[model samples]
Target: MEIFIVVLILLLSIVISNILSRLIPFVPVPLIQITFGIILGVLPTGIHMPLEPELFMVLFIAPLLYNDGKMTSREELWKIKSPVFLMSFGLVLATVLIVGYIIHFMIPDIPLSASFALAAILSPTDAVAVSSLSERIHLPEKIMTLLEGEALTNDASGLVAFKFAIAATVTGVFSFANAALSFFVIAVGGFLVGAVLALIIARLTAFIRRLGLEDATFHVLMQIISPFVIYLVSEELGLSGILAVVSGGIVYSLQSDYSEPIISKLKFVSRSTWSVLIFIINGLVFLILGLQIPDVMSVIFRDDTISNFKVLMYIVVISIVLILLRFIWVYSLWNEKWSVNESIEENPNRFLNSLLTSLAGVRGAITLAGAFSIPFYLENGQYFPQRDIIIFISAGVILLTIFIASFVLPLLVKNKNIEADKNSSKLNQQALKSVMNAAIRLINDETNQENKLAASSLINVCEKIKNDNPIDKEDIKLTIEDRKIEKDIFLLGIRAERKEVRRLLSDNKIPPATYEKIDNSLTKVENCLSKPPIIETLNRMDSIKNFISKFLKKQLNVNPINIKDIKKIKVLTSKAAIYAIKEQINDTNKKASLAVIDHYNDIIRRLTTFTIGEDINNVNKQRSKLHLKALQAERDQVQSLLQNNEINRETALKLRNFINYMEATAIEEQSF
Candidate 1:
């Protein structure tokens, strides 16, 4: 139970951090999460969660790498493959060698092997952290892609080096030639193993389908578990599990069926699942780092050999050295022009770009995980030399890198475009309007009476979306009279719905629970109509609004309604509201009154369909099909618009996603 509570608390912190990051967009999410973890560390329920390297890799790294591999564009990766390889492998090796010596020279107490291990741990750059930093400002597409690709492969290279260093430290042996040979075997072997396993899995799935067994969710689940399965298998075979998962993801993407509807659905589900899984895992990594900080720092501070000030200096020096090394490496690569998408002639400021890239090499999860993974005890049964201090320094480096990147990168690369965003929003509304119109056309053409009636109700819904989505500021400007008419009609409609609910509840047609739910909903709408205010102002406003209602409450002393009357109550009340609007309607308010009347009439139609409860299964099936067809029409229209350049890719994507959600909701409703 305590364990369960701890898990809940950690999860709650992640949620709170997510909220804080959104509310404070300038602050990166990982920083917020780390802060929360720091706060939790000082609390009574301070968590000291163990960080096992093998478990961490399997749970977080493998799947995340797999997803990244799957999503990376093969063409784009191919274009900059050389740069990516150089940075991921070459730069990583250089950083480990160069930084390792620097650390050893600075802190002679830490052995050279231990220093190399720490260096290896910090070698890999975090694309995720860079992405978080880039949320507000877009990095050059060329640099972003290069960073992403480097991050993908460097995890394997850096960790492989760390493994070698750790092994040397444990057994008191070191050989560069043997390690290089072993790396080649492990990398190639892991790649082959993952590719083979993915092919086997894909073939097995096809065989199952040939046997007339088809389930998208089942296939998607298999895909979800593939990384873990591949990782374990590769590790068992004495190979690189990281490379295996990466290759497995790439191979799986190649074998996927792109044109099939079921495959599309599976992809959607898989993407959503991976997105959520990666987010939580990524968040927990930083959170756990923050939790571990206090313990790591405490050990370092308590040591007689090292002063707290020296430790701080070590962190600052190491962090600065790493950044300088990165800047030098990036600067050297500029001779090749880094195969950037933009021409050098167009954006000739190469030095600035290199510096931005250098700043962007932010260390994150892998670094923290590797530091913690350092064995507590050596092979001779003695505690690993300066293990806590090593972890502490590594943690400090991660924090400094992220901190620097968050504040520095935005200033270096200015990509925020307010006008572009506004234009995109207008385009999104245009796409939505086009799609809704297409859907309305399809529903109007339906021949089946019941299907038409059920789907026809959605036409108003589509129209409302179109109307509410104003394409320009001028379209949203409403006159005082118009606002007054809208407010009055909304209040009257709410009162009618409330009256119906009370009449039914009093006659025992709906139980107390249902009445309470309905009453609460009506109260919410009323509250929205009149904004919350101070007690005196609120009371004054309520008195004015309830004057007529107070007299009507006294007149509610009437006979009980029958079951048949209850069945017709909603439709009858909607009609009553419409009639009341018409009675109060004048030439000046005709447009506003008709708009409200249309909404009430929609409620009547929906109620009428609900009252036809007989043959519900058939009705539901028809409704589902119609809903899906309408959504399909919307999707087709979006595609057409994209092809015509009526909307940009981003706007079309948003519209398609909106339609996809509605389609998913319809399918979910049908399933239930």
Candidate 2:
């Protein structure tokens, strides 16, 4: 029960942090989450979330590394293997030797081995944190790749070095030759074990398929658990569990058939699952660090030998040294002499790239976890020297580095070319337009009139298809015949909206959360449309009650719309509506169908006739105005139908609600 409460609290903190992040977009999410954690620590609830290093390794670190390994581009990794090795292994070793000595020299009370241990743990950068930060700023491709590759490989190397240092400290003995041999065996043995296990699992999957036991959920579950299994097995055999998981993930990636339809379906589920899992784990890691920090600080303050200002200065100095050493190392790798065979010497961004790399090498929970793992006592039954201080310094460095990078990286990135971004945006718009055109053309080519009409009605709702001329408010004079046609369109439109949202989800164009929101809205509208008038009224009442309940509990925040994409969808939908209406004109009430055709034709005219030279903001404004007019016209038609006794109360009410929803969506889009 205690464990459950702690888990619940951590999850709640993550939710709050996400909400705050959306509200305050300027601050990086990791920083906001850490701040929340700090607030939790300062609360008087006396919450103490203990950091269990081994458990943390298995639960969080293993899966994270596995996912990173699988997702990281194999081609990019191969292209930059030399630099990756330099950063992951060489830089880590150098940091340990140089920073370790400097730390001991600065704080003579800390034994040399303990100092090295601190440096070793801090050497590994948190790529997850850096990746989150990089989302706001466009990082150079090579720099991003190198950072990811280094982060993937360095965690294991850093942890291994840390363990060796810890051993030396506990036993009061050190052997370079023995340690070197053990490191080689540990790293190699881990990779071999991981690779073999992955191969075995692949074969096992084939065997299951042959036995006709093909379940996507079962396969995904196995994949999920494989990292933990490989880590445990490797650790049991005294190999590097971190390396094992990484290698296993890479091996699994290599063996998987991505082109297969079944694999594509599974990828969708797997991607979502891993995304959520990583998010929660990453959040909990930072929050738990925040929880542990208060106790670590109190312990540091209890030491009368060190002043608070001096301890802070120590953290500042150590952080600077780490960054300086990393910059020097990365800069050396970027030098003309170092790149004699490579064309990288001519790249003008080398200095900034090196600086970015150095700044990006911020330490995270791994450092604190390793620090927490430090032995409490040495061989002589005396306390390990300055253990609490080491943890405090580690915690301090994590916060300071993240805070510095949050501010500094963006300033550095501001110098990046604006034209490149504009060109990219232009290309995206063109691609979206092309996709919309192709979808319409596909519908136009359909031979069966009924099939085309059905598809057209759906495309109309989903794409918000508009025609050339804006219908006058007085133009809509619904007869019973017109009402029946409009009812068919409305019912079909609801179904189409649901289908299109699903298609967008499957295509990975919109996120699942966005899909869920739009689907829920459409579902409620559908329920109201399908029910009897009394039930429909009751349903509306229930909806209002639920809305109030939600308002009192959680704020409903909708995702922002891309006006360009919405406009493209509308254009395609209009074309579809025109094609379907022309087909129907030959079979249905000619006058009523013509009026509907005129309504859509007016939409197309407004959408297509807008000045091409206008700025995007002007265009968006014009489009929003047009959309609102269209929505109001729709509401007017529904009202006309009700007055003519064409649609009953339930149908009229549902149509009005649907129009209201669309108008609300358009208004929200205008803000963006």
Candidate 3:
């Protein structure tokens, strides 16, 4: 019952933390969760986890770190590998040595080994916390990647160093040679284990795909289990579990057939799952931190031997040191010959960007894990010197850093090159122009006389942008109105002709061969009209038109085509052009459809343009024009029937109407 209640409470805390995160924009999520946790801890009926330090560390910290490795971009990490290596390894070691020495001097009663252990534990930064903060603040990608990569690698490094330091304290022995050899073995062994495992999994996936049993559920199951398996295998081999996960992620990414349909579906599912998991984990961790505050404060107050005021003062001072040290390290490196961005072209904003990067270094889970992992006792049955105090100080620093990053960082840094708000409008304008151009090129390429009217209608649409703003509010309304009218006319024409054709066939007035042919033709037109206009075609048309317009303006002596004039021409020629254009449009559409069946290379491109619903209207307009031409061609045939006295003027007129309807339907079917 107690266990159940505790679990329920923890889950509730997580939910509350997430809600608070959404509500508050300037406060870091972890901090909010922690505050909630502290309130819960102070309550009379609050839940207590009673977690064993090692179990807690392994369960929470290990998976969190492993997840970070899996999501990080490999190519970006490789670009700044040098700095990431130095910061994760060299800087962490330096920080440990310096902090250890200071602690030993200030607290004479504390063992040097225990002091070093504390320093080593505190050295690694939290990748999750830093990544979350960086994303919100719009931290430069290069710097964020550098920090994330370093944080990920150093978790393993820091843990290894802490274990070695604890061993030295417990066993009363220290050997530099042993430490150096163990580090190399662990890091190298982890990489190998991860790589081999990933290769095996990828091969298995390929085999399954070849067997035609590639399902999203199976792929998702593999994704869920891969990280845990990689970590466990590496840990069993006395290697870095974090590095194993990192290596596996890189290998799997390289080997997997990500383009497969099943794989794409799995990716979407996996990504959403991970996002929710990370959010809950981070929120719970912070909330737990907050809940533990009252317990920590009680310990400080109850123990009269250590002054509570002095302990709080030390925590505040050390946090300042941590923040300042990061700035000093980054800025000093920036000034050196081996500085980041030194090889690139220099700019005044580079220093400012680097400063913002340095300021973004906020501590969270890694610090908590390290502080919590401190041993309770020294070699001689004495309490680990200042262990409780160190944990308290680390927690305080984490809160302070979160505050500064959330509120202060944004004020200090501004992106000079481009703002996100401005970039959106620019991208929209570029996209609109590209689509208009592609439509015009498609129309102009028509070779059949029957298709010319449809082509001309499309040309008018493309040309409208020349005289009017394509993106203007009023222009968009007008364009939409024209589209609506075209759709209605085309659909009405299709319905009227389909009814007439069916009636003629039912009455047996038309021959069976002619009836079947007309029915098939009407079905094709119906299918074409059913689809909506292709947004991609519109975008591509805009691009092609803009390119041609620019080329003509710059290189050609001829004046640009008047888009307004084209629109007017379409309106005037619509009735006369319908039949012949409808037939040509139908032929083109049939060619495109057949091309797909025959596996023609350009079939996909042609079908993409021709199948638009708006093209139905465009086809109808062309057919009206073509019908006029066809009517002219059939004049002799009609006159011969009249001269032979086989048909009266009334019958001839009805026959002409039927022919016109058939041509209109055909043209409307294939406007692309």
Candidate 4:
């Protein structure tokens, strides 16, 4: 019942925090939530929520850190690796030693062991908190990256140091050699375990994908299981779970092909879900911090046995010292030239940015959990020294930092506009568009010419036959000379059209849509022209006609014509061609129609390449006109052949009719 009530309150707080976040964008939501928690904690109802520090760390901190690590750009991380590592690991160790000593010496009432534990708990910065704050501010990417990276990496170091300190105190022994050796083994061993596990998981996932399983389910399961497995396994093996989780996250990210369709979809879903969870966790932690304020005050004030003023003074002093110590430590590194910026102002601002990174260090769940987890007493009945005082101080520092960092730091920095690297990106996009447009134009033009020539040849062959002559099938055959001439003319037209489209594309007059429509029509024509003309295969003729209709629909931007419409046109054309061929008709209509169809296809292709508003150069339009001339020449050849009886009149009529169909289709399609 207690657990359920706590959870309900946490949920309710999250809802309220989200609403408040929007209303007050300048103040962070976490800070607001923690303030709320502090208020709740002081209530007479005694609404205290207990969360085991270890469990909370694993469930919330681990995933949040893992995500921060993943999103950090690889190049930026590597560039600042030295400073990041130093700040996270070296500074954490320094903070523990320095602060622990100060607390012990300045306040004799606090035990050395307890001081060190408190210092250790406070050593590591919260990556989740830092990252959240960074996003809200206009901090430089490199600065944000350094802070987040340091926070993430230092948590493990700080935890390890804290454990060693605790062990030394409990066992009444301190050995530098053993502690150093243990740290080495735990860090190295945890990393190795995480790496191996990550590799194995990557391979297994790839295998699963190959087996044709649904990608969504597999990816979701991977997200749910990977972190826990890594942490638990490493800990069970007597290695650092923090190191293990970090190692696993890095290795898994490097190894996995997140570009795969399933993985991509899963990533989107996981990111959205994880973002909310982390927010609520941080919100609840902070809100609870706020709720504890009244209780903390009640304990100190009501219990006159303890000096409330002195305690408050000590907390203020320690918090100031902690904040100052960070600035001093950061300043010491100034002489080292850690970054490209040589100017003192620039370098220090970078350092300052890191210092103020996530000011809302509201020591929420972790501080509370760690403070509460203090060993009650030895069997001899000796009490822990200043345990409650340490808790109060830690909580105080968290509240102080959260408020100052979120509200104060923004005032310190000068505001400036920051823009993305747009010049390079713009150039790249333009280059890509140009190349694609060129390729499209080239293909469209060539196909168009081929269609026109085939039409002309068919018309010519039909005109050469006579209807009244004795049905001598051998005479019906198209002469080699005639076939060769037709093929040459068709090939020439295609070449001319290709050149013209290229010119128009260069000029930037033809729009992409215009090019696409013409290209599609040409593609259909090419397919039809590839096969020999066969009267029995009326379906093929239907297909060719359908292509023409589709081309027209595209040009006119009209609703698509159905297959039935295509079939009807094919039947009509095929019947006319057949009648002309059987009667040896002298119309030579087939040859003319074929030629026109070929020319029309070429024109459409050119139009598609010539981006209407784009090509100001007039190059593409001029080239298109040249190809049109070539088409005209072929049309004239078909006319000559028909007049000379090389094609019968019926065939000529059929060719003319086909040409009309091609013209109308191309015109309509081009309009679209």
Please count the clashing residue pairs in each candidate, in the order shown: 0, 14, 49, 74
- Candidate 2 displacement at residue 139 in angstroms: 1.4
RMSD of every candidate to native, in Å, equals 9.3, 16.0, 20.0, 22.7
Query: Candidate 2, residue 390: CA error in Å?
Result: 0.7
Q: What TM-score does model 4 achieve against the real structure?
A: 0.59
Predicted candidate 2 versus true structure: per-residue lDDT over 278-326, tens digit per residue: 7788787778778888888888788787798999999999999999999
TM-score of 1: 0.69
Whole-structure CA lDDT of model 2: 0.70
Highest TM-score scorer: 1
User: Tens digit of lDDT per residue, candidate 4, span 81-152?
Assistant: 888877877888888999999988878887787678888877877665665555345344455556667766
Candidate whose lDDT is highest: 1
* TM-scores vs. true structure, each candidate: 0.69, 0.68, 0.61, 0.59
TM-score of 2: 0.68
Q: Give the total clashing residue pairs for model 2.
A: 14
Give stretches of model 3 more than 4 Å off: 1-9, 51-53, 208-213, 257-262, 335-351, 415-672
lDDT, each prediction: 0.73, 0.70, 0.60, 0.57
Candidate ranking under TM-score, highest first, comes to: 1, 2, 3, 4
What tens digits encode model 1's per-residue C-alpha lDDT throughout 1-672? 988988799889988887776578678778998888888886786887767778978987888788777766677778888888889999989998999999999988888999999999999997556545555445655677788788888888898999999999888999999999998898889989988998898888778877877786787788889999999999999998988988888888888744354454455556557667767877777787788777777788788877889889899999999999988988887744553433212433668778877888999877888888888788999888888888889989999988988887766654422324534555566667888988886776663666765675677778987877633322342222354566577678778778877887889877765565455545544554443224325645655765665467569863332333433655665676777777888887777677668766765675566655556545666777787778877876775565333454455645654554355346423331
List runs of model 1 lying over 4 Å from the truth: 127-140, 257-259, 335-349, 376-383, 413-672
